[model samples]
Target: MTTDTLRASRTFSDWIPASWAYPETGATRDLRFDYMRGFVIPLLFATHFDFFSLLMFVGWERIGIVSTAEIFVILSGVVVGMVYGKKVKRDGLPATMPGLIQRSVDLYRISVVMILLVAAIRYVPWIDSTVITTFFDAPNNQTYQLYPPLDGSLSTLISKALLLQIGPHQFQVIGMYVVMFILITPLVFFMLSKQRVWLLLGISWVVYAIHYGAPFQSLRPTGAQFEYAFPIMAWQLIYVHGIVVGYYKQEVVAFFRTVWGKWLIVASVLLSLGFMFLTWNHPLPHIPQWITLNMIPAETFHYLNNEYFSKSKIGIGRLLNVVVLFISIYALLTLCWQPLNRALGWFFIPLGQASLYVFFIHVFLLLAIMNTPLPGYKDFWINTALHIGLLAVVWVMVKKEFLFRWIPH
Candidate 1:
């Protein structure tokens, strides 16, 4: 091989990673892609994730909306990349494995810090363990199981400090969910480059479905691991899609303009909203009658009765909601969000770029004071103000020139 060929084979990735990772051609393009690493894309997601979070937290007796929101968006990011990769290859673009690796490394490093924070919540001194008090608990726990209570013991302090072994019996915790993404995202790049996207998606989805135990609905949460949960899987779909779209810029944009794309978007949205309403309220709404709203609690039938939806299976409503969400996000990129064509940018783009910092900080702050005798959970107005206030602080720290370097560099 020629000297030039040897270098290309080694440092960059093999199998044509992603065209989007590099500019279409020369120096300017490469720089532009790098700048993207800084902002705009992350914000689009941050808004959407938080939007759902607000919805999830709207009333009484629901999961922790903010935590669920954070995990979903992060997982969805992986899905976006997976889907985008396939489209890129079909459009005759180069592969993006090398770029994907670079991104994965960035994510891994972030996970490391989150792991440490989880440890510190159990042992760190004055930083107020409140930020990460819930780190020790299972993902979907109620009040009593929030976290490992701090014991002020030396052994517990040293043991819980690392991601690998928190204590004698502690499993690898903290951002292990993110660790799952780092492991699997590169595989997406590999499959997509080979035009085997449907195969990969099919496999992932089936695994996801079985993992959900939807077919058995009455199943209990036994050996089920956190990796296969649908809420997380739904997010993974987003990252896959982004990768596919980036790969097949021409094809995706074309599809968006087609009538089918428009119809897909509309139908998905209407159905998603309808499902949301039905899931929140039980009674299943007679399908023939039209959109129905029952103010009664969903638990009356689904959980309390142990009749339907009690199983871990992915119900029609939840699956459809996932589909609707997926198509809507994709539709924007295909239709108007032609990232390459536009020189214009949104103002929140900068803030969005440093999204991980915001995400980590926001989670830490919320959990820190979560269970203390603080004025949250019960005080709706105060909690709303606090959430908004936290957002502002993070925005300034992350976006403002003065403290930007110190935010999390």
Candidate 2:
């Protein structure tokens, strides 16, 4: 009886809890939430994209805000199960290794397409921070610019093209995503289709605890922040959580409506609060140039670039942050407060469904506009506004245009 999407869209794909309420009247499709696998992804993307864009440009090249970009981006990718829950339906779980390998290749092609588009936009003026290529040194010399504009490196150029090289000053390391997803997804999907996922996850946590935290040293072209590759191990549990939660919506909904579930939510909240309080004052972990130690293979030019790792074991704070994010989200959803719940359901549905295209397109579109220099300061301002503005235009335009259809959710 509600006048929301269940009634608004004429033709719909069968999907979602909302659709369940109006089974005959509506259909849910790609964006439908699958409880567990579904919740955090949209939350993560909306959170990341909102924060990343609004952080404001401090210099010609860097973010004005704190550098949580690494964790945010990786979490965003893991949260992507809202989409994957739908994708795997159509694509089918590649049962055999051959099928999985083929699916990996296909996804690689998709990632490559996204990479090339972002790369082309590199020529655009204010978008990709090309000016940074001309300015700063990596080690902050308060006396001078620690990070400079490296517009002259062939290796850097090659790095961008490949999207996954262990060097400095490289950007848009999307290839790493392609690789991680391909290698990880098959097992992840297999786990999801089965009922005993908790057993596997417990083992995964132990495996992670013992190993080097996902070898996150590979993030950011070994040293440059530009090639910021997200860490898979850091958020692997989260991604698995996405799949687990989504695949068993009915059980999750029932659990949420239970007394014990309510307690779990409360416990999660307490855990989150405690974790944040303790970790807030902790310092960022500084990584010695792990690349040059030749404990790892690397570029000859790969000198030690100081990065603050957030894993407690490796001294990176991310381990704490991830725990905070996981617990807080779990508690929030389990509580089922109406208005807040409704808001997350609505926004997260769009954000989660549209995330892949949203992210890839955002980078591409912004770069296209910013990479090209405009006439004056006013014109430059307009270009920046356009960066935010054209998203609406692209969304509307994507409807009739098949090629651009990929732009919309």
Q: Model 2, 1-409: lDDT tens per residue?
A: 4555343222222232343332222232322332322333322222222222321232111211123333334444444443454455556556344555764676566554554444444466545544222223334532222122246465555464454332212223334445556656667666655545788678557645544434544432233233233444544544455455555544654574466755665565675565444333222222223211233223211221123333222233444445445545544433332444466554344444444454455544433444455413434345345434554444443333435343423
Give the candidate number with the greatest TM-score: 1
Q: lDDT tens digits, residues 1-409, model 1?
A: 2443333222333343332222222111222222333332233223322322232233221211111232234334533443444444454334555555565566555655555556555554555543333333233443232333555565654444433223211112224335545666667667766778789777777655554554442332322122222234433443455455455555653564466755776787676555455554544321211322457565554553243232123343444454465554443332233353354334334544554555555555555445455443445455455545555665666655543443343
Q: Candidate 2's C-alpha lDDT?
A: 0.41
Once fitted onto the true fold, the runs of candidate 1 whose alpha carbons sit more than 4 angstroms away are 1-99, 124-131, 135-177, 214-242, 279-293, 296-316, 329-348, 367-377, 401-409
Once model 1 is optimally superposed onto the true structure by TM-score, how far is the C-alpha of residue 5 displaced, in angstroms? 40
Range of the 10 consecutive residues with the lowest summed lDDT in candidate 1: 59-68
TM-score of each: 0.59, 0.53
Quote model 2's TM-score.
0.53
